[model samples]
Target: MSQSNQQRIWQVVSQIPKGKIASYGQVAAQAGIPQAARLVGNVLRKLPEGSKLPWHRVVNSQRKISFPIGSPAYQEQRQRLLAEGVVFNKETIAINHLAWSS
Candidate 1:
């Protein structure tokens, strides 16, 4: 994806409200690339540290964090979600309850 597309993805991600999450596919759709869900992940992974974008709010379609179990990224993502009051059912987030529609 071009830099502009990535920026658009970042802009869309930044708008996700606190306590709500969006699937990677949803972020891609909002960014005007409906089929680029994996691309959304790529863009997020490349985000600079301390970015204002809410990268943790982007989850898989199954409402799970994309990081591997026991990894630092997984732990951090879980921490951020919990801090935002996002409830998880086992390994899956309760996305139906907390998904941001816009």
Candidate 2:
């Protein structure tokens, strides 16, 4: 993807408020690159270590963390969301209540 598109993805992710979540598709759409959901995930995955862009606030369209279930990455994402007051029903977040609208 283009650097500008990547930056746009990051900017949208940065705006996801604490206790709120956004799907990859939502981020891509908000970044002005509709239908680029996978690109959004790729941008987030390659975020530099120690970057503070709130990457964990982005999840899959299913309202689930993209990381493998029970894995360390999954656990970390879950913990971060929990710490931010996101309520999960089983493995899925309560998306209707917590999804970020921007």
Candidate 3:
């Protein structure tokens, strides 16, 4: 993706408040790149180490972490969300209650 597109995705992600989440597709749409959900994931995956962007706040459309269950990445994402007061029901987040509308 172009730098501008990546920046747009990052900016939108940064706006997702603590305790709220957005789908990859939702982040793409909010960045004005409709139909580019995978692009959002790619951009997030490339974020630099120690970056302040809330990459963990973006999940699959089902509101589940995209990392394989039981993986370190999955655990980290779940932990971060939980720390932010996001509730999960089993492996899926309570999206209706925690989705970021913006």
* Number of the predicted model whose lDDT against the real structure is largest: 3
Colliding pairs, model 1: none
Q: Give me the displacement of residue 89 in model 3, in angstroms.
A: 1.4
Could you give candidate 3's per-residue lDDT for residues 1-102 as a string of tens digits? 456988899999999988789999999999999999999999999889999999999999998999999999999999999888888877878654645534
Ranking by TM-score: 3, 2, 1
Candidates' lDDT values, in order? Answer: 0.88, 0.88, 0.89
Q: What 10-residue stretch in candidate 1 is worst by lDDT? A: 93-102
* Residue 87 in model 1: lDDT: 85
By summed lDDT, the worst window of 10 consecutive residues in model 3 runs over 93-102
lDDT by residue for model 2 (1-102), tens? 556998899889999998889999999999999999999989988989899999989999998999989999899999999989888877877644645534
Best prediction by TM-score:
3
Give the clashing residue pairs of candidate 2, or none. none
Q: Write the per-residue lDDT of candidate 1 for residues 30-74, one digit (tens) a residue.
A: 999999999999999888897888999999998888988779999
Q: In angstroms, give how far residue 3 of model 3 lies from its true place.
A: 6.6
In candidate 1 the C-alpha lDDT for residue 4 amounts to: 87
- Residue-pair clash count for candidate 2: 0
